[model samples]
Target: MTEPTFFETPQPVDLATIAEWAGAELVRGDGAAEITGVAPVEAARPGMLVFFDNMIYADRLAATEAAACLVTKKHQAKVPDHVAVLVCKDAYKSWAQVLSKLYPAAVVPADPGPNTISERALVDPAARLERDVRVEAGAVIGAGVEIGSGTVVRANAVIGPGCRIGRHCVVGPNVTVQHALIGDRVYLHPGVCIGQDGFGYAMGPQGHLKVPQIGRVVIQDDVEIGANTTVDRGANRDTVIGEGTKIDNQVQIGHNVEIGRHCVIVSQVGLSGSCKLEDFVAIGGQSGVRGHVTIGMGAQIAAVSVVNDDVPVGGRYGGTPAKPVKQWFREVTALRKLAERTPST
Candidate 1:
């Protein structure tokens, strides 16, 4: 049996070319030194490039067997003489640039079939699709839907009535979109359910009266939503996902949520209705923001946190009913010390 290779192998590139692409200085290497692949310092081979940014991995750098490595000036001295060194201000960002040059096609979603629409797909006569739009098998596009050029609607995906998707988008397999307007270069991964009814109801002793959700979802450009994530429609206002925001899998976004540009929401995060996240906010995995709360710009919420109130700008918060990071750490340390000092019964 043979192992599977999903991407094509790249040709060998010399150290000088890699330095040029990464905007790095080849401080301790021959210009002719070449590598065919990239790997971690711990797992590097003779023809692989590795990156080191911290002194904590000094042992790995000291024993690296790779052809070359990318490092900062402060840590370059620890690298083994057998391995060549390329110096850069930001090692991780440089590595990303080098990878982009090596694997150009790896950044985008995979196309399942040709650029033309498959015969097994169903499209209403009122729906308009621009040139180079590909619709795969078992997909259904409803009336008055407009899809732009260079977009691919993959297998079994359904676009409900009056939905508009912009150019260069990829709607993945088994996705459902209703009452939504998606901007250019948006990627909705498999099983993403958009614009569903919100959990709004009038509670009573005998029965619960359901409130009608009458709003839509507006997703801006360069947004990538992961698999099985659900974005519920608002009751009277729109739920907006801002441009360049990246959301991980299994996230639950409640109605009327407003996420600002370039925010990152990790997996299993639950956002209650009307929560607002300002620009550049980062919410870690398994975090929850209470309804009507606002996370200020550039704030960071640590993993498994519960945010119940508004956070000030640039604050880093953690713990349940999340507080400032320094205070949280102090409280945690105090509890641990108290536990250690108390006599056991």
Candidate 2:
């Protein structure tokens, strides 16, 4: 299979030209140098542009093979004499801006490679099933289930009556989806059970009764769910995942969980029911949160952290009972200091 040739435009741009195009403040070294590629400082070759966003990597930038580099205004003087530097107010932001322009995202079509669809299955008239969308012998789909250009629906991957799967999305083997609106460039790995019953129970004097989950799952664009990651159906409202959210394998999302855009949820992270994680929040591996908690925007919960209450925005937290990142660092530092001062036998 031939991969789509992006970045194949042979327009070799110069350092000064790229800096000007990206609205960066240019510091000249060799304006005539032709830049053929963009890479990291450590891996950049001759004729490529590298970027130094953090101070920790300043020394590495001096030894880089890149003909030019992007740097922050504060760090411009630190660059070596041989390399041309493009100064920007924000190095990371500028780097992202430049790289995005150089290499854009792609959506590839899925070919249903030799799968047979049974006559009993109902494929939507308006849907475009790519190469391998196999309607299992007994599976059914509602109207307007537009499978993307390259999406494959394996045997028994029962898509709900009215769902929209974007391009290159794999309705993973045996996965069941219902009453959901999925976005483009989405990937659903095998055994991913979406729109399932929520774990809601009411305990009374007589017995415990289960609360009916009447909500659905709304997975947005550029989302990739790991294998077997089960997103429970909402109790009353939809469980929403913002665009570009990547969920790792074996993660369990409870009912009514609202995960904001671009969040990275690592493996085995269990979000309790009704937890709202705002934009750019990162949940480390094996992290678990209590129900009804709100993790504010840009907050990071370290691996294995147990969040029991609401977290503030931009806070970094760690430990079993999660605390502020600064506090966690201080506790570790104090412990180390105490050990150093202790009298040994």
Candidate 3:
């Protein structure tokens, strides 16, 4: 894979301006100086600045060689007289401002390739097609299916009639979608089956009949779904995803599942129908979630957990039959301690 190129160099900024921008007070140790770069405390040099978020590294303040440092208000006194300190309520916030000022990365647009599309392929005339937007021989596109400037739809990547794709969004080769809304900066890996048939079946007196999947999948911006991750269309309502939710390869998301923003679902994680996960939920690799379960915000499920019940907010859970993270830790610790204490005669 080709590494992306940097767009521009850092613009020089002073500590006073940084302090004003971050709503922090600048407590100077020396004259006002320009910060050209930022790095870890141990790695900072004469022209670069650094940040200290905790007290574990307070002892290293005497040895820091940077021009200045950003520290929390509580830790400001720990800085030695040799270095200047920028005190803020949150050191991380100040660090982010400084980093953004110093190291803004470049944005690269997708390059559309010269793949061929059939003349009869129904592409919306208003859709934006870039250099490498390839429509295959017989695919039909609805109006308002905005193919980002550089996306390629393989011979059969049937984009449902009215989808909006951001720049560089990839509708991989042979994928199918209908009435779906996709955000910008999204990537649909190859063989990804989105807006597909759900495993919905109706039981009659004689046999089981299939229920039609009539809903759509709404994917937010900056999401990267792995290859072959099949997100089933809803049964009656939309299956929605928040921004930056990453679904790993081969994951199965059942109908009407709502995944919150920035959640990471690892490979082979199976979410049954109508599950709701709040923001920042991290489902470990191969975990299975029962249908209609609501996982609270910021919960972490360890790998291979079989979650049959709802998880509380801001907790970590782990087990074959998932339990709270602290309990799981205790169980593992007790077993390990017992093994260590056993006689070795």
- Expressed as tens digits, the lDDT of each residue in 134-231 for candidate 3 is 67666667666777655556556777666666665767666777657788778777778888778899998999999988888999999988888898
Top-TM-score candidate index: 1
Estimate the TM-score of every prediction. 0.96, 0.71, 0.65
| Whole-model lDDT values for every prediction | 0.94, 0.82, 0.80
Model 2 clash pairs are 109-150, 110-150, 111-131, 111-132, 112-131, 112-132, 142-161
Candidate 3 Cα deviation (angstroms), residue 69? 2.2
- How would you encode candidate 1's per-residue C-alpha lDDT over 11-30 as one tens digit per residue? 99999999998899999879
Return the candidate ranking by TM-score, descending. 1, 2, 3
Off by over 4 Å in 2: 1-11, 30-32, 105-158, 165-176, 183-193, 199-212, 220-229, 243-251, 261-268, 279-282, 313-315, 338-345
Candidate achieving higher lDDT, 1 or 2: 1
Please give the TM-score that candidate 3 achieves against the real structure.
0.65
Residue-level lDDT of model 2, residues 1-345, one tens digit each, is 998964444368877778876678777676667889888888988888887878788778878888888888778887778788888887777877776666643232234455666786767676556654556555666676666655666666788766777765667677888767788768787788888899999999999999889888999998989888999989999999999999999999999999999999999999999999999999999999999999999999999999998999998999868999788889989999999999988
- Runs in model 1 lying further than 4 Å from the true structure: 111-113
Off by over 4 Å in 3: 1-7, 54-63, 77-81, 106-123, 126-160, 165-179, 183-212, 220-232, 243-254, 261-270, 279-288, 297-306, 313-316
lDDT of 1 at 9: 80
